[model samples]
Target chain A: MESPVDIQDLEIRLLLETMLHRYGYDFRNYTHASLKRRLLQCLAVCNITHISEAIPKIIHDRAFLDQLIYAMSVTVTECFRDPPFYRLLRERVIPLLATYPFINIWHAGCATGEEVYSMAILLQEEGLYNRVRIFATDINGKSLHQAKEGIYTIQNMEEYAQNYQESGGKASLPNYYHSKYDLARMHSSLKENIIFAAHNLATDNVFSETHLVMCRNVLIYFDQTLKNRALRLFDESLVHGGFLCLGTKESLSFSEISDRFTPVSQDLRIFQKKRGIR
Target chain B: MKSPHQRRAIVIGCSAGGLQALRTLLPELPPTYPLPILVVQHIPANSTGLHTTLLNHFCQLPILEANDKDPIRPGWVHFAPAGYHLLVEPNETIALSIDPKVNHSRPSIDLLFESAADVYQKGLIGVLLTGASQDGAQGLLKILHRGGITLVQDPKTAEAPLMPRFAIAIGAATKTLSLKEIGHTLKQLGADTRE
Candidate 1:
């Protein structure tokens, strides 16, 4: 007899397939280990004993499905979470971007807009904000709405302030946002050039001629096939000599699109789109 | 007890004073230690490459931070990256997850040990070390139930004894030894397969 754990694995696969075929949300390409953990968490939240038991409710109930989507994708983020990554962007990439007449940055899988605002703050400090348009996208609509609002928990500001200083911020981080009622609303100026949209890296088309594509911490959730698909999309979207930045733990060394870009900072996982496809 | 040759992997879980424990324990494993050592040390999400870098100084075997889909290689210590759960696939490859934290830790000991138990089954060796929480108790129990060997640090010697004490309370540990003894036991358990 198969173990309960093995049965759970099978149920997870079937549920992922159902979510894809029924709802057109292709979590089928997500990393199986993470997906299974997230789905199990979803099952527990719904008070369901098994993944198979939750499939009917997921298919029939929109609210439950929405909750599942939010829970499945790791939406937990903070403004300027990785200080050094932003420091690298400030020191290396922004100078090249400044030379361009107009700059477009895609914050792909931009969960809750922390890094989007981080990028805006960087550009503003560098006196480059007017020429930049940031496209912040994620598959979760709720996260996108939150991102659009540009408001965050005030409790996070202290740490963000620390991160901003560590990332070579010219001025204080608190200068960028106002605190009221336990929330920090970013200054209106930061939102002027940001476009928040719902775009799935697994199935969506590329945003054209982007100067920098920042998809950090997001690719770790994808299986190899989907990772390559997203990398290809980023490659297609980036202009010649544009930048591609990923999370600290993520790398393109083993990526299918490896040759299409060269590492600008191997330690930071920052790469520049090569002038020619290899 | 299975022979050294039969063992596939060593899954270790530690928290609290884990870094100090690993610094002392990892150096004792011989240079040719044959099984891949997978570790989950509870750390803050923002912590960077410092853990592996610090441990590498004392380790003869190469110590690396575990990345998604990395193939398990013998004679290397793979630390679970902060902010992600590290799992073992049936193929024995390392997989990572951004799933919700368990026991208030992202790279939860229970997640790693349980997944590894599922993958390696009878070929696994689970070790629970110094920790402040009960994170690895259920995982150690799972490993024990799956016919794998499970060890725990002797609660008397641990900096934070609750984790090992809990595992012992649940009868998850087959042997409970001091940190030094645990190191010696690992060397003996892995002696036959040395390259």
Candidate 2:
């Protein structure tokens, strides 16, 4: 007789496979503990316990899967999560990026677009806004819509202000947003250079040549094989000697392509692809 | 159920200043090392190649970036690629998770350590090396709580002291040594494979 644990494992695998075939968002490769947690959460909300009990309802119910995606995709991002990294970018990256006639910046997994606006504001301060084309992408359509709206709760502005100041703001942080009804609508000009769209790093191929790719706090959810695939795409997408900025907790040390890149600020998790050497 | 001999596996985590540190540390492991070496080096989604190429040059053992569902094997170095947290199952299978970033890192040392503690218990050996952040401290503590052995690079000699210092401050480390000492200790421990 098969043990209960074995049965549960099989059921979970089946549930994941069904989700993949029906929804096309693959969770098969995600770590088991996290996936199990999310699945349990989904079951609780739906008022069920077993995978078999939840499977039929999820397969027939589009709303149920959307809810699950929302649960799975809830990333904790606040404005300027690591302020010093941005500060270093303003000081180090901008000077070199400025030399280019026109520049393309790719913000991968740009959830809700706070970082995109942050980058835009920085570029504007450096007089590089007009010549820069920013591509901001996320897998969530809802987040993309919110990013395009360019509006945020004023409650968030306080933290944003602190982050902006720490990231070496040349002017008042409030200058970039119009405040009304405790909501801050960012300056319309910041969106002019940015193209926000849905792009899944898990499955999407490279879309454009980029001079700088800022993919922060996104890769930690991926398995190693997926990470390698994504890195290869990023490598192909970047122009020779392009800049790649990762989150402070992240590094390029174990990557297969570490030799192709050189650390700009190893402490800040900033790297520049080797020029003329690759 | 304490076995007659320790059923050992190696877990390593690195971040800021890690590439140079890894370049130094990974090269020191011989290909014939009998135990599996698992690593979590925080990186973006686009950098797994660095792990593979570096280990290929230095280690005689086969080195490969990990894949979801890959089984853990001795004499191989497996790295958590970019975005995922790599965990060890009770059966010693590699499980990948997209859990929200713990300790603000996806390839977080905490995730690896905590999971290994649950799965390998006293059989696990956790190593915290050069990094700029405090991600590994709590995880290493979990490992120690589960009776696993833990090691940290001596902060003074670490490329970045924040991570090692945090581990030491929390009293999670069993030994704090320089990279040279760490390499030598791993060689000895890894040589004692049961299978």
Best by TM-score: 1
What is the DockQ of the complex in model 1?
Answer: 0.51
Over the stretch A1-278, how does candidate 1's per-residue lDDT look in tens digits?
Answer: 88877887788888888888889888877766667767777788778997898889878998988999988885677788778888999999999999999999999999889889999999999999999999999999988898899898888887789989999999999899999989999999999999999899888898667999999889878877889999999998999999999887788867888888899999888999888664
Models, CA RMSD each: 2.2, 9.2
Q: Which ten residues in a row have the lowest lDDT in candidate 2 chain A?
A: A29-38
Estimate, for each residue in B1-195, the C-alpha lDDT of model 1 and write its tens digit.
666566788999999999998888899998888899999999988788698998888889999998777889988889899888888876677777666688888899999998888888888899999999989999999999988989899999999999999999999999999989989888887886553
Q: Per-residue CA lDDT of candidate 2, range B1-195, in tens?
A: 545257578899989888777677777777677778898988875463676786677667787777655779987888887767788865577766555677788877887887777667678889999899999898899878877788899999987899999999989999999888888888767655543
lDDT of each candidate versus the true structure:
0.88, 0.80
TM-score to true structure, per model: 0.94, 0.64
lDDT score for residue B140 of model 2 = 90
Candidate 1, residue A178: lDDT: 94
> A186-242, model 2: which lDDT tens digit per residue?
999888999998887777789999999998766655555566666777788888879
User: TM-score, B chain, candidate 1?
Assistant: 0.97
Model 2: how large is the Cα RMSD against the reference?
Answer: 9.2
Given candidate 1, what's the lDDT at residue B6? 69
- Model 1's CAPRI class? medium
